[model samples]
Target chain A: GESVGLHLPTLSVQEGDNSIINCAYSNSASDYFIWYKQESGKGPQFIIDIRSNMDKRQGQRVTVLLNKTVKHLSLQIAATQPGDSAVYFCAVHNSNSGYALNFGKGTSLLVTP
Target chain B: DVKVTQSSRYLVKRTGEKVFLECVQDMDHENMFWYRQDPGLGLRLIYFSYDVKMKEKGDIPEGYSVSREKKERFSLILESASTNQTSMYLCASSLFSGAGELFFGEGSRLTVL
Candidate 1:
């Protein structure tokens, strides 16, 4: 079974600052990617997503960057808030294989006031 | 609005006891999923249903069974709960039609003593 690891690279940002959380995926054939935000005692919410054909996509206060060449994806949060503190996950899917998402080990983002 | 809701926020059961976890989705999405989250493991798929009465096994399906009699409901069952099965269980849903983003529920933390 593909399992997420406990150890994760963490990033800390002050309130009103910008935050960027990066992840490196293992499978190169993955064509779609999404970023999820999980707060304490809550389920994960969709932050942003980017397809493999594109390099970057932006949403409300969030941006997702996908680099297929490096099998890397990143989430950028603009004007980080204390409420933005969360464990962020990157999930990849291969369109050719029924599109099951393969998740990367998440990164923890701590936004300080 | 909560798109997905789990039946319990926490559960305590003795070893070898049968347990059931219920989930319901209100968005009318065709895809419903059950996943377990551990301290080190982010989220592992236990089972998923694409439609009523249809199901598929995800990355980790051992010791688990699922039932999906209706489009909006999905249930996970542990025939015999073990200490290894104690973890946070989450349910999610998503639409088909080429859009692949999942909306998750606040997890059910189960403890098997």
Candidate 2:
């Protein structure tokens, strides 16, 4: 069965600290991966994406790393802030399924002062 | 900014009632999707359309149907709303096919009594 899953259900971090969220996928055919951030009552927003052709991709304050060898993907947030507290999800796109995304259970990040 | 707009931000319905959720995208995307977000469970894809009038079933398509009458509009129909069907419904769009970054609209929180 092809599925995407997160390593942890929740993460607590202090302000100004770096945060890392992990995701694992079962589909080897997956070539494109994306990270999304969702606020309390909002939809998922794109943060960063990494293709299988590249090991890493970086956005303004976020970085996404793709390790095809282990079928792992990770999102790293630099200097986590209160505004960064949200649920983060990782999605995978396989060539076999055009336009369909397999999303992992989200990790809720809580940044405290 | 890429805009995906959902028709309703919140909705309340009774069991056995038919419900409709509409989504529109301004990016001239070829793909549109509907997903439901629930507690503990991640985003589950209900349905997606790669092109107008071409709909496909996603992982969790039971109890839901989709319509893509036009390129910019996609609609999710719940044949009979149930208490178990209450969830946060998200709509998304992507420019082309597989591996494209998805742009999501603010979700519509539906409550079925």
Candidate 3:
């Protein structure tokens, strides 16, 4: 059974601090990964994505690091702000399962003032 | 701007009732998916379609069915809704067959009493 899981259920950080969310996947053959952010009343939006071939990928204020050896993935948010407070999810592409993505239970990030 | 629109924002229905959730995408994407989001469970794929009139069952599709008569419209049908079926249903579309980024709708929250 292929599964994606998060290390933490919730994370709290100060307004200007950096935030890190961690995820672990079971399938070693999985190659593509994605990070999504969901706000209070909105659908999850894509934040960043990385392939197995790439060790890290950077977006505007976010970075995704993938360690294939450990089947671990992490999202780093620099200078986390109030608007960055949301549930972050890591998804793995399951090629065997009709190419649908398998999403891990998200980590809720709260940026306090 | 890619847009995926869900017809209903929220709905409440009694047990054994039939429910229909509609989703439409404007991107002319070849891939469309339906997933359910729950607390501590993240998102679980229910069904996905890669082409018109073609549908595939995802990880959790036992209580749900999907219809994709048209390329841009995908509908999720609950034959007889149950209390356990209450969840937030999200619809998403992607250009590729689940390998690319997915554009999601606001989501339709259904409560089965």
Candidate 4:
């Protein structure tokens, strides 16, 4: 399978270690944010989301933190496994673009045993 | 499970050829989007539709058009394919609310010669 993010930033973590991925947006008015995971040869899969009103949201083994003050978002994964290896993308909803979601250049996460 | 189905997984066309990419969502989402993904560039929106028979241009809508004749279906059309248009095309659907998370298809990889 062809890799998704060949030239984007990369993070390598050993199995069982926690991983954090960060994203920054230029729009402070962006009220919605989402995290997506895309494996090789597949489209992005929704992992989690957070609204501007909330600072943090957690899912099973995954946590999404939103810092509206700085227009930053981060995804934290606990107990990382090899299956978690993929390209992760952060999407922001831009009201100026008629509420279309704009995606960031993905971060390639490689979980090694 | 919510499924967004893309009609073609891979396609090859020559310059000046007409190309059509079909997307269907089983979740009956109100908003559907077409985006092209390239290495290091993330995903760029081509077009989107929030309702049947209605369309909106995204940040990068040139050379692309879309149709949403039915609630569950959205189509991306390239009037005349170009080599620069060759990329991994992704289709996604979300609820009407601007804050809703997007669900994406497996994607259609198109190559224009």
Candidate 5:
């Protein structure tokens, strides 16, 4: 089945270092993509988003890059901090599916001090 | 600020019991969604409502049903709860059924024994 999936399930990074998470999507028609951060016992929070028309989008400390040719997506977080420890998920919006999002399994990011 | 509120943070139910999870959004969004979060499974959409009284089944909607009688509220129902139905339920709302971020509630953790 065509779905969004993450390459790694867990990632550990040192505080002050940068962290990167990768995702692969199978659908070619998806036009929008979003990244969410989820803390323990809480709902997923919107981190950043990018559209297929643009290759990259930057937020406060995060950046999302999309490669339509290979159907790959990546999230880069700069200066990782202890508070940045959480699960990150990449979601793709299927316009044909009436605004539903296809989410990746998620990558657990742990920033060690 | 947009706020999505779930009725319960945790619930315990016996097998074969009927379960109901309620969600309400204050933003008067036109789209609402219900998803189940499990370890290694990410967010699996159970159902979604685009407008009042309009419902659509998601990928894993076999054991779930939804009700959206009003614009601000959406409900998820488990006809016969089973042990396998134990999971964290998340409710989300969006302004429209297009490319945008979803505002999610805290979540409801259900345990069926």
Candidate 6:
């Protein structure tokens, strides 16, 4: 079955270090992608989003990069902090009009202070 | 700031029991969705509503049903709960279509015994 997957199931980083999370999607028709962070006992929170038309989009301390040719996506976070520890998920928006997102298995990010 | 709130943070149900999860959004979003997240499988969509009284079955809606009596409220129902139905359920809302990042509530953790 077609699916989206994260390269790593868990990541550990030190405070003040940069962190990178990768995702690979199977559907070529996916036109939009989003990154979400889920803390303990909380729902997924929106971090950043990017459309297929553009290659990269930057937020406060995060950046989303998309590679349509490889069907890959990545999220880069600058200055890892304790508050950044959470499960990060990558979601893709289908090209069809159903307005649903396909999500990947989350990657647990642990920031060590 | 937009907020999505769930009625419960934790719920416990016995086998064959019916369960309901409620979600409300302060923002007048046209699109509301329900999802269940599990380890390895990630977040699977249960159901979604684009408007009041309109619902669509998502990827995994076999043992579940949904209701959207009002534009700001979406509810997920488990016709008969089972052990395998235990998971963290999340509710999210967004604007019409897939134009914006989704706003999510604190998830409801369901434990089916």
What tens-digit string does per-residue lDDT give for candidate 6 at A1-113?
A: 34899999999999999999999999888888999999888889889999989999999999999999999999999999899999999998876636788889999999998
The top-ranked prediction according to DockQ is: 2
Model 5, span B2-106: residue lDDT tens: 999999999999999999999999998999999999999999989999999999998899988999999999999999999999999999999967688999999
Q: Residue B19 error for model 2, in Å?
A: 0.7
- DockQ of predictions, in order shown: 0.58, 0.87, 0.77, 0.70, 0.82, 0.71
Q: Please give each candidate's TM-score.
A: 0.92, 0.97, 0.98, 0.94, 0.98, 0.96
Give a tens-digit lDDT track for model 4, residues A1-113.
11122224899999999999988888777878889999999999999988888999999999999887867789999999999999999888756656477788899999999
Clashes of each: 0, 0, 0, 0, 0, 0
Error of 2 at A74 (Å): 1.0
Over A10-95, each residue of candidate 1 has an lDDT whose tens digit, in order, gives 88889999988887766666777888999989999988888888999999999888777866777889999988998988876774
**Fraction of real interface contacts that model 4 preserves:** 0.70
Candidate order by lDDT, highest to lowest? 5, 3, 2, 6, 4, 1
Clashing pairs in 6: none
What stretches of model 1 exceed 4 Å from their correct place? A1-8, A96-99, B97-99
Q: Which residue ranges in model 6 land beyond 4 Å of their true spot? A: none
Worst 10 residues of 3 chain B by lDDT: B95-104
Q: Output the worst ten-in-a-row residue range by lDDT, candidate 6 chain B.
A: B95-104
lDDT (10s digit) by residue, model 2, range A1-113? 46899999999999999999999999899989999999998889988888889999888889888999999999999999999999999999887766788889999999999
Task: Supply the TM-score of chain A against the true chain A for every candidate structure.
Answer: 0.86, 0.96, 0.97, 0.91, 0.96, 0.95
**How far off is each candidate at the interface, as Cα RMSD in Å?**
2.1, 0.9, 1.1, 1.3, 0.9, 1.5
Off by over 4 Å in 3: none
Alpha-carbon deviation at B68 in model 2, angstroms: 1.3
Error of 2 at B51 (Å): 1.2
Quality of candidate 6 docking, DockQ: 0.71
